[model samples]
Target: MQVFGIAEPGAPAEEIEIATPELTGASVLVKITHSGICHSDVHCAEGYFDLGDAGQMPVTDAGAEYPFVLGHEIVGEVVAAGPEAGVEPGDTKYIVYPWIGCGECQPCRDDNENYCIGAKRNLSIALKGGFAREVWVPDSRYLIPVGDLDPAWAATLACSGVTGYAAVSKVLTEEVDRPIAVVGTGGVGLSAVALLAARGHKNIVAADVNEASLENARKAGATATVLTTGADPVTDLVTAGGGKLAGAIDFVNNGATSGLALGAMGIGGKLVSVGLFGGQLAFPTTVMALNQLKIEGNFVGSLPQLRALVDLANSTELPKLPITEAPLEAQTVNDTLQGLAERTVVGRFVMVS
Candidate 1:
C-alpha cells in the first residue's frame, strides 16, 4: 500500500510504502477511489489549533502522533471483508464514516459517537485514514453505501456535506420571516446554501470576504450574497438580509465570524457555529439575556444523519459546487493543504486513486 503521510508534526506529507492491512475480525478493507482534502486536515498537518487568548492546543494533546495519514472524507470500493462484516467483496462502493468511538460509551450507544469521550478512534485523527490506496475500516457499520451519486462528490458527504446539513437543519426547524445567513462561503457554507435551497428555503443570504466564494454561493442557491469586507460587515449583512437575520450558521466559527453572526441576528435568532477554525466566544451577557438568542455548537453529525444525507444525494439534484480532481501524490497532497489554508481553492478538492 502506498500512502502520503507526515513523518513528524508540522512536516510535509511524503509517500511511503507499507504492507497492505489484513482483514481480521469484523474489519473491512476498502480500495480507495476518491478522498476529499478537508480544511481540518490542514489543522492536523500543522499540529495545533489557535485558542485565541487561552493559547494553542497541540494535536499531540488530542492523541495525534507522527507518521500520520490524514484524509477522512473517503469514498471507496469494498475489496475484502471479514466474516462478521456486513459488506461483501466485488464492486460495492461506500462512503467511509470516519468518526468512530468506543462502542460501549454512552455517546456511542446513543449513536452520537462523534461526541464520544472514552476513546477517540476518529479516522484521519487517530487511525490511518484514506490518504492511501487502501484503508482498513474496523467494522462495516461505518460504511454507508453510495448509490448512483458521483464518487468524487459522494466523498465530501462524509464530512462537509453532513456537517453542513446538520448545521442548516438546526435553524430550519421553524419558519422565519427573515433570511437565514450562511457565514464563511466555504465548502460547508456552500453546502448549506444548496441544501437550504433544495429544502425549499427561498430567502438565503450568503456572507464571505472572498468574491469567488460569494459567486460560488450564488450558484449554490443563495438568494442574496453579502461581501463581508466593509467597516461594518455585520451591518452590511443585516442590511443585505433585509434588516435582520432570523438565524446565522457560522461555518467560519472564528472570532470575527462569530461576532458578525451574533451582531446580524434579530431577537430570538439562532446561531449555529460548526467550523473548527478555532477561537473564543465573547458576547455581552446582558444582550444574550435580553434578546433570548441561542448559540449552539454542532459537530459533524450522527450515523442516522449521514444516512439521510446519502438518501438525499441519491434522490435529489444537489447544488453542483466546483470540484477539482488530482492524483493522490505527496506533492499534490502538500500543495492542496497549502491552497486550502491560504483560501486559494474555491470548492472541494478530491484526490483520485
Candidate 2:
C-alpha cells in the first residue's frame, strides 16, 4: 500500500510504500477509493491545536522512520471483512467515524464514545491514518455503510457531514429555538447550514468574508449571509439577527468569528463550537454569566448517528452535492491539502485510488 502523510510539522505530505497493515479483531481492511481533504487535516498537520490540552494527545514527529497516514475523512469500499463483520466484499461504500472508542470503555458502552480515552490512546499517534491506498480500521463500528451514495462525497460524510448533523442534533435536543447563525462558511459550515435548514431552521445566518463561501451557504439554506469586514465585523451578524440570535454555531474558532457568534446570541442561546480553523478565542465570562448561555464543543459523531444521517441524505430529493474527485497520486495528495489551506477548494476534495 502507498500512503501520503506529513514528513514533519509544517511539511508537505510525503508518499511512501509499505506492507499492508494487519487487521486487529473485527477490523476490516478497506481499499480506500475516495477520501476527503478536511480543514482539520490542515490543523492537525500544521500544529494549531498542538498545546496538547488536558487529555489532548501530542502530535509525534512525522519525520521518524515511519510517517503515519494523516486522513480521517475516509470513504472506501469493503474489499474484505474479518472473521465476523458487517461489511462484506463488493459492498457499494461506507464512511469512517474517525474518533473511535474502545468497546470496553464506559463511554463506549454508553454509545458516547466521542470522549473515549481508550480509543484516543491507540489512534492518536502520527503512525496511522486513512490517507493511503488501503488502510485498516479497528472494527466495522467505524464504517457506516453508504450504499449507492456518491462515493466521492460519501467519504466526507464521515467527518464534516456527521459532525454537522450531530451539532445541530444537540441544538434540537436541547429544545433551543431562535434564529441561528453559523460563524464560518467552509465545507463543514455549509453542511451545517444545509442540515439545519433540512431540519426546518430557515432563520439562519452565515458569516464569511469570502463571497464564494457566502454564496455556497445561501445555496445550503442560509436565509442571510454576512461578510465579515470593517471594524466590529460582527455588526452584520447582529443586524441579521434582528435584535438577538436564538442560537449560533462557531465553525471558525478565531477571535473575530467566535466573538460575533457569541455576541449575537440572545439569552439562553446555545453556542456549539465546531472547528478550530482560526484557532483559540477567549470569551467574556461576564457576558456568559449575564446571558445565562451554554456552550459546547462538537466532534465527529458515532456510527449509528452517521447511519441515521446517511438515511436522511438519501431521502432528500435534491441533486447530489457538488462533490469533486482527484486522483490519489503524490501530487494530488499534496495539492488537496494545499488547496484547503489556501481556501481554493469550495466543496470536499475526494481522493480516488
Best prediction by TM-score: 1
Task: Give the range where candidate 1 is weakest over 10 consecutive residues by summed lDDT.
Answer: 170-179
Kindly list the per-residue Cα lDDT of model 2 for residues 1-353, writing each as its tens digit.
67785666667777888776565567788788777777777766664354223333335532223364677777777777787666677856777777666668888888777766563522324236677877777787777776777777777777778888888877653333457888777667888888888887758888888888888888878888888875766677878756577788887766667777888778888888877654456789999999998888887787677888889888874223577787876677678778888988766677887
Reference-based lDDT, each prediction: 0.86, 0.73
Q: Model 1: per-residue lDDT, tens digit, 1-353?
A: 67787988779998898666677778898889998999889988988877778888888786666788999999998888988987788777899998888777898999988788787888887778888888888889999988888999999998899998888888884564478999988678888999988887878999999999899899888989999888989888988888777899999899889988988888999999888878888888888899899999898977778999899888888875778999977888899999988989877899997
Q: How much is 268 displaced in model 1, in angstroms?
A: 2.4
Q: How many clashes in each structure?
A: 0, 0
TM-score, each model?
0.93, 0.87
- For residue 199, model 2's alpha carbon misses the true position, in angstroms, by 1.2
Alpha-carbon shift of residue 10 in model 2 (angstroms):
3.8
Number of clashes found in candidate 2: 0
- Residue pairs with clashing backbones, model 2: none
